[model samples]
Target chain A: MEEGCSCIYSRMASRFSIGLLMILAIVLLMVRVLYVIYRCGKPLPKGVSQSFTTLIVLGSGGHTAEMLSLLSVLRKDRFTPRFYIAAATDNMSLQKARSFEDSVAEKPAVKEASQFMQIYRSREVGQSYVTSVWTTIVAIVHALWLMIRIRPQVILCNGPGTCIPLCVIAFVFKVLGIRWSSIFYVESVARVKKLSLSGLLLYKLRIADQFFVQWPQLHKKYPRAHYVGCLMIEF
Target chain B: MEDRENAKRVVFVTVGTTSFDALVKAVVSEDVKDELQKRGFTHLLIQMGRGIFFPTKCDGADGSLVVDYFTFSSSIADYIRSASLVISHAGSGSIFETLKLGKPLIVVVNEDLMDNHQCELAEALEERKHLYYTRPHTLYQTLKKMELESLVRYTPGDGTPVARIIDRFLGFPDD
Candidate 1:
């Protein structure tokens, strides 16, 4: 009788430990979810109004100049624009981009260098598809961190490479009821394959309240596209 | 030609990221080199694209020509300004920059003959009498017949398709 009772006790103990571990995992997951919500919930700090805050430009190389030129024109009002150039590893274009950003900005600018995005040059291989997907994840994490810190009202994307991931973060913010912030897509769909990619990409972009395109050609490709005249240099 | 009257006539050969075999064939051909040498060209500058495996050097049979390679240079615009003739890849950036400098240009397209966006650009400019173009197979024949005067009258206006796209980005009329 005692042996049977001890056997019952051992079984009960095993079940209890298993149950305790399961409860612990659930609590941990709940805490993580709450923490994410809390972090996402926090508003931009006092005096860091999205309207007057600096815009974070997220590309390197010649494309950086294009964005800088756009920012130069937009700096006429009571706002200060800053830049964060996402450069490739050991690229001359990265150096040129940094120098250009330094020369243009009136105030001290913010710059971040990472090998998070790069253009695939090979035609025989389809490495870009995989690289692009991975880049999207990294960009989202980086953008989330930036959003928590800078809290800019708008994030302007000039390249499809980094813009895709940043758009995902913007979507998350939209879901959390952060309606004041906006995301912008610069380039238009030219090829059919690119159009299909844009269709999948549009899910992330639905969070963008305003969508701008340079050409009327894109209207046939993307029905929801709004024609914003090209961003030209005033000088 | 008059734009760079002070500078000697320099033929810029740029076989962009097309095929190295095509470029080698174009350069090795006797007719094209002989014609260029006869023109009293002062120098030959080659912007060999990515696929070129060897260093650029003089190749004329007469051994009187000088060839220079430009890989990556901060002074590309200055070099373009100094050149009497600008030969470039059919890539939009090169095409736009050459036109922006108001220099005589010769574009070589990379299309697989069937799908030819570059060929289209070349034909449109050729119709406008703005530039010269040659297929890989007929490069020598085309070069021998190209009239320098026909190319001199063509100058591309301000900005390119990309610049126009930017203009549209800024909300300017496409026209």
Candidate 2:
């Protein structure tokens, strides 16, 4: 009876220890996230002005085309933004994006050092939680490598799919005192209506520093959002 | 006799995506086929997209509506040019492409059973009067009475709105 009592006590102690460890880990993670948010929410550090070298554009399909067209128009002047196109595997936009980058490289002003990262398509498996987590991990590693190599001050995101992972990496960098801003391009008013409740909640997290929307109606939706008249590359 | 025959109205059916069930229904329905035959519409050309299954015979109009499934080899611009009236799915890509060609388009919304987004897109287009929208149930009736030239013109420009939105976010000049 004493041996059984001791065994029960030991089992309870082990369980307590595991629970305690999990609680400690969660607390540490929360602290890190809070720290990141605090750091990124602030202004850039003084006397550390660097020219925007690389601009990572994240999206697939027609959204990428829209970004490339905007970049082409903007490339005419002083700002020469290098392209980092992130896409999903077997995406039609990714194939076209390669050709777009090749064509842009031919231009005198735009120096091409394009990197393509493929994320797993969510549609195939009805939202892949495991693949999503894996993609996020890979994105963080890739972002760190690119930050060290390319040294971009600005990250332009066209949509949520690719941007969400990239933005998390940006937040990590922000915590480390690396100066960067995330610019989000809003496609349509219809998109705002289509966002899932979880997505809206995530948006409130302010992963993006600035949001530009085509429709004036979105200005009401995102009070802090800027309404740009429109960006177009005239053919 | 040849001159008179050449002047017959050409009805063009363009399927932007194979997922469009309304287009399939419109083409295969016996009632619609009979009505089209009675109307003396000449040279019915059907542009089939990927994943769309075509019947061997469209009720004795086998040769009338030629199905070009996933044929990106030839430019579809030529077909849009020759079409007197263009019938298509209500995808933004198709709507813009057809409008750019200055053709009269009758857009059929792929039902909620097909895709919910199609209905939303069709509703938006109908509100703008850019194209005539046909629900799955009323597609045949809508097509029969569709007046191409009467459509309100909605010009779809380049991605200026999207660009402007991005520029604003980037803190660039709105202009």
Candidate 3:
């Protein structure tokens, strides 16, 4: 009877150890996620004269227009070798970006440092849920390939479904200590009262290093988002 | 009186990317045309976008007003720049472009649009006295009451703050 009781006790003890290990694993993961969120944006150890490689994402129509307008203000000298990525279906945005780069090139000391790339759209409007699942996976894989190839130090994107996959991969890279690709998301001026889907995900997940909203009302609702006023203005 | 009659005050009506049949239909009605003519607008240029409703009335057949339209344009900037007044659907692009050009603007909120964010922008801008907002049914009334001189000039937003944030994020010492 003593031997049987001891056997039961051993079984229970092993089960308890397994449960403890799972709890510990979950806690560690939570800590790591928090660490990556708050630990970032703390000034990196870098020289004052250092330049950064930036990836600028161009969404459709208004989003693209706003991003280009915002880009007008950023110092080209500081964000060198810029990568402008647009959805493969959107030819006009890339054309617009190229012209913008051409205009910037007119200013002396600005070299031809801009590169244009197209990635698969994560979801097309009115696509079926089943098909979208497959397409989303394809898009994510494409995004992962681009992330690995570019290994950008900074990513600037407004509200675009495509940005979600890229940002997720970037966050994973941060978690793995592969690279710290800081994400900066600017909510479109069109979004006055609420955040766009991509903006909400980035904001809630703590993936975006910096979030900006054009309207004051949005900033009030989402306290974390910086109220930067209307960004779609003449330079 | 002669100079006012001869002045080419163009009122550009744009649906912008998405279709708003109601806006197109309402603007072309007799009452709205009479209102524009009364307001001393010499031309009515409509960018109908993807709307199925083709405006057929007052296509310069009447010498009092000149009306022209196209489904789309390569760029609407030139049109907006030449226009003295703009009546636009509540698309942020159209609203900002018209405002940036310092043109008197009336934004018609499309009630059919699933997203209400567009309406929010229109309301906010209207509240600031930057522009006027109305529904298609009440556009004629809004146009009648629109005082262009009362509209406040929209000062373009500065990008310095965003630049500073980016700089700070990258660890570039504040200058």
Index of the highest-TM-score prediction: 3
Residue A90, model 1: lDDT of 26
lDDT of 1 by residue, A1-235 (tens): 9999999999999999999999999897767545544443233343344234334444433345445445554432223344343533325545654565565545653333111223322121244676767765565566566556555555566553545544565556555556344454554212211232433364233644345454455556666555554443322
Worst 10 residues of 2 chain B by lDDT: B65-74
Error of 1 at A7 (Å): 30
Clashing pairs in 2: A230-B164, A231-B160, A231-B164
A196 in model 3: Cα distance from truth in Å?
A: 1.7
lDDT of 3 by residue, A99-195 (tens): 8888888564565588899999867877889998899889989999998988888899998788888888899898878888778999998888889
Q: Is model 3 an incorrect, acceptable, medium or high docking prediction?
A: medium
Q: Report the Cα lDDT for residue A121, model 3.
A: 86
TM-score of each: 0.59, 0.69, 0.90
Candidate 3 chain A lDDT trough over 10 residues, lowest sum: A40-49
Please report the candidate that would top lDDT against the real structure: 3
> Scoring only chain A, what TM-score does candidate 1 earn?
0.53
Tens-digit lDDT track of model 2 for B120-165: 5556666677778886578789867866567886654455554454
The candidate that wins on DockQ is 3
User: Candidates ranked by TM-score, best first?
Assistant: 3, 2, 1
Residue-wise C-alpha lDDT for candidate 3, range B1-175, written one tens digit per residue: 4664578899999998879999999998889999999988888999999999998745454566778889899789899999999999988888898999999999999999786678888898899999999999999999888898999999988888998988887777778
Instruction: Compare candidates 2 and 3 on TM-score and give the better one.
Output: 3
